[model samples]
Target: MRSSPVSRCRMHCYFETGSPMCGGGTRTVFSKRRAGSGVLSPVREGSTLTHGAQKGSISNYEVYLGALVGTLLGAAPAVLADNPIIQTLYSTDPAPYVWNDTVWLFTGHDEPNSDWFTMKDWRLFSSTDMVNWRDWGKMMSVETFSWASADAWAGQVIERNGKFYYYVPVTRKGSSMGIGVGVSDSITGPYKDAIGAPLVANSAIDPTVWIDDDGQAYLYWGNPNLYYIKLNEDMISYSGGINTVDLSSFQGHFEEAPWLYKRDSTYYLAYAGHCCSEDLRYSTAPGPTGPWTYRGQVMPTQGSSFTNHPGIIDYKDGSYLFYHNGALPGGGGFTRSVAVEKFEYGSDGSIPTMDMTTEGAPQIAPLDPYARVEAETIAFSSGLSTEPSSDGGGIHVTSISNGDYIKVKGVGFGDSGAASVSLRVAAANGGAKVELRLGSRTGAVIASCSVDATGGADVWKTISCPLSGSATGQQDLFFNFVGGGDQNLFKFNWWQFARK
Candidate 1:
């Protein structure tokens, strides 16, 4: 088998909204704060460290020394991320597009606790530093296409003529898998179906789109065989009939997930090669449609998932390869997670073999903490979920419980330091504190602000608290949740720091 056609699976499952598998919960507002207190332990700062009054205090000198000591000891910077980049949900089939200075990652959402590929919608996540990603939530879904019934499998997005177009494979009603195109004015979109019907419908899947310097666009996709169609300037339609790639002329077993990119003058086609367990392989051509010469493996078969997908792009003088793996807790073939690796092509323009890792690509630059940062923007998170805010402000972090934490890696607090921080939060039940910690989750508490009920979980409030210790330079910032009771604590919208 070239690759398992997920749409061909005999079994399928769909969960209703707000189910346990979706991590849904109830919310209620309380006037009184819950009865409980937690010990606030600051990093050792001689005798200056104090813990009480729902706040912790530490010395500025110690913060500086700790940073210096960590640097001297060669401690891995928090900016360096762990793999399976997405922790809040299972995101698969990464399609990375570089627009302006940010990398916009479009992926398909794998439903939780699924026995088979149960995908309904597509998601969008973007990052400036590539370590901390802000979830843009659902960009589009099968619901967007009235004619499509299921299989929001793999898709790719491209920007042309200032408009963003998404190409995805969906199961057509009473028919086989057909490709659909979505278009949006903004990169972050509420995309609409560009064409009411399948752009092309021969049971082909995993659509990857690329445009050449000559203003000609190409859409490539298929399994068991390879095919391409020259897309017109409109993007919603094609210029000619479907064309097939001569698989026999090309080297290697080209399974599926065809990613097309042009490096200088060479056209490269990277795909999932072999079956049962897939590895990444590529072939190079002098032109867009190839007499492709087999280039060896880009990534060997590894990770927990049996199937693999590839998305490659170059951003900010660096080359990155994005792929899917079942590396997260409870992750498997049907519930896959997307991970990225930084790699360099051989001087001859051939790709080098890369490995999937927990410590994913390093932060190209530190994140600016002074700016307003969305709570859903995370490098790593534990015990929390994200959903659309009731205030119509995109997505917010929800389902927060005691000990839940969101880590923002490589946060540059700067030399002047931060004086205080304000958080946009909502709480149904009171008795929760957002602890601002540095370095490690347990490293040191700089500020701990108690959150009170804001009338409803949907009713948001902004609370500001002073920072007791100096938070300067580049550091990994952890928003550690501490509260009493097992019920949901609060919902986090966004946060920003005030300069000292």
Candidate 2:
């Protein structure tokens, strides 16, 4: 039995109408189906197994061999490599696509407020898990865009009429950093600015290009206005009135930076808000042009402070949010490191849980350094420890010494490799807010930022804290020996780590 590629999110199964023993098997399942023409849809059936087990027939082990879900993408299996993970695949912004079984994203090669601000460069990274990322060095440059003397903020890659188009925003001192267009032949490219003109400058920052279901095209800018345009058959030029969506209706919403996508007959309008520092909330809407609604707050999902800046990607039979979190580190807010969580539509027809990290979604492999790891309770002695209530499996930490130093051991899969453990610590007496420190090395603090914990108890939810100390690619971790707080009790469900 073989399943047919129905759409980007599903497969049209062709089965022999009998059980496996009857010389027949099922190809197409109900959960996913072929992406037919028009708006995408929810197949709803095959998603669940005999019990309440989630996940389709897809298996992680087979992913390496390029096993596929369906044809919606021609290069299906090629994109399923989520292991030997690529740490961070995101560049300055989120670039998405629907062709192969992966989402190919483009971003910058450096960070801001750092040393590499003036020298603008680009890179290409793709992933199916949205966890690990693959970095394809320097693809474009400041020289590619017309007025881009420096600063390539928000740029989008759109494929239409058989050609690839890259749209970017640039600025040079007094001259407003406007949006410029770049053209390329391959997904990875040395794109040249198309019109030799800013895609649309004067007040616009990040520029995005979205093609509608009708095959008609539109260009969205970062001006708090949903700019619309019709693509000339080649999808190279603009044709319609630049429509404006007055987001003024919502407060704490600014900076524009938008990405538009369509799903199940509805359009999802995603954009970053709040200051460049924090208060960032990744939002969505029902149409490209909208009475946009606030789904959830973005940035700094963990501790407080501010956390804005992000990009959204839909892949792996799910929609995932990719953005840099405000991890308490030397450059926490400014680092702009990438992290991902499955973005699901909430019950009220709005965005679902934006709990910083998508807590339980099958942890996918990543594409860059600060490689992602989960929290688990693998040890227990005296003192105290935190473990997942849902699945009594993971790492276990017990207090030693003065309850200041906590030791953790792998539980579930037995040290797939020497795992580096990070403990999410909240101040014993509201000390330094709440911080995350590594327990392995004597005195290392990875992320010093803290956030809204139940507060009553010292209990904190332990997650795969990014490795910050040493170079195993773990993020926001430095072996800060976990413990403290009179009520140092916290809720730790899982621990994410990569066994080297």
Candidate 3:
């Protein structure tokens, strides 16, 4: 399938809506001209470029020419991404923690076709721009906790005193459910069971941990009820007894997943509220253990999932809410996907109700096209998976078939324009061609490079291809794969574009 030249030209105008070339206005239309014309006749800036413009008003030739000029002049359009940030896997119960400029996301991996929350492991991913997330792969799983038997459910990790601690709920032997703590020296960990047993067992789940300004730490978790514990300096051990907070003032049914944090001396507790199909709600207190006051719903009963988990954090001067829903294809209550939304708090430090959106969050900054971008770093992807390279290095893209593509959004090519693209690829099979498209799957093909087999899949090689079309400005790049058979085509490690 391919977009008609006329439609492509119209899209180009739409993409350039808010640029100086278009008078920093809305849509602009070019005057009509014959197809295959060498030159683009200029139309007045801010002219309305509708799809069904009257004949002789905006010619298809002018539209195409405008696109070409826009690209050559380094006026690339910004591509905004939608929700369900991770496409290659089903993620749920998002737990985001900021460590050194990047937001580290730890989520429950929902097994495909799961009928009843059959989660067995957790996944870790991180992002600085929010739009492009780098997959860190499986961080820890059921086997991580030796004493625990099954159910690697929702959890939260915190860094303290040069050590990282993860609190999660799992099924303990001879018990229904218990919360366990895992400790590691690094944030991304092969964590060890800190306390060879459940830290606090009471048929509870969904553990959220937070540390206060005065060097005190607290762990909160439970479903249908809320519990808290004061941890000692070691973090793995707690001195105080488990205390349950009074939820009589909470607006809705307080279920589980308590996210505790502090801002401006006020302590906030956000949790999944109401029954069955859960919505997010919160309460505030003057102290960590509160004489709490119910604030109200943060997110309403939306998204297809029956239950919801909340992870809230403030990063890069913006507040964000991370949750899960059955919004992906073949997703449901059991099989869910994680998503995020940028939000604002009320004037009084109270959280306002936020709705779920496909457009999750805006990019913090544009991606530099000249840098060596990992193939696994993706804003959006289709028909592909990532794995550790066999050469004992960083991650690489795999499970690629014909029509498989990876979309890197907001790539800024600069004014000079990119002359060529370089890729580190490997293929045991014959080889394949990667078509570089802009805007959409059937959008304009700017470049195509045939990757040659490097004798084996693990045998790596560098390949370069000259870009044929305009490659300037900020545009969403689509690396579309095409091959002869239905098997794997090749593996891509990293890619970058060089300026002319």
Pairwise TM-score winner, candidates 2 and 3:
3
Give the per-residue lDDT digits (tens) of candidate 1, residues 156-213.
9999998999999998999888999999999999799999999999987988889999
Error of 3 at 104 (Å): 1.0
Over 405-500, each residue of candidate 3 has an lDDT whose tens digit, in order, gives 788887888888899999999999765899999877678898999988888989999899999999888888889899977646898899999989
Q: Which candidate is the best by TM-score?
A: 1
lDDT of 2 at 64: 20
Ranking of models by TM-score? 1, 3, 2
lDDT of 2 by residue, 1-500 (tens): 00001111011111232221111232112112123321111222233321222121111211222222334545443222222121221124555565567777666433423422333666666555443333445667787764557765656787866668877767744676666777877777757767877656555665667777777777776544445555666655667656666666556565455667777766766565543223345445656666666666544323211233445655666766655432211112223333355667666546654544212134443322223333321111112322223323333332221232222221122223224443343322333222334433223554443333444444454434443434333322222323344433343333344444
Clashes of each: 1, 74, 5
Task: Specify the poorest-scoring 10-residue window by lDDT in model 2.
Answer: 1-10
Prediction 1 global C-alpha lDDT: 0.77
The regions of model 3 sitting more than 4 angstroms off are 1-81
Error of 1 at 133 (Å): 0.4
Clash number for model 2?
A: 74
Q: Which ten residues in a row have the lowest lDDT in candidate 1?
A: 26-35
- Local accuracy by lDDT, each model: 0.77, 0.43, 0.75
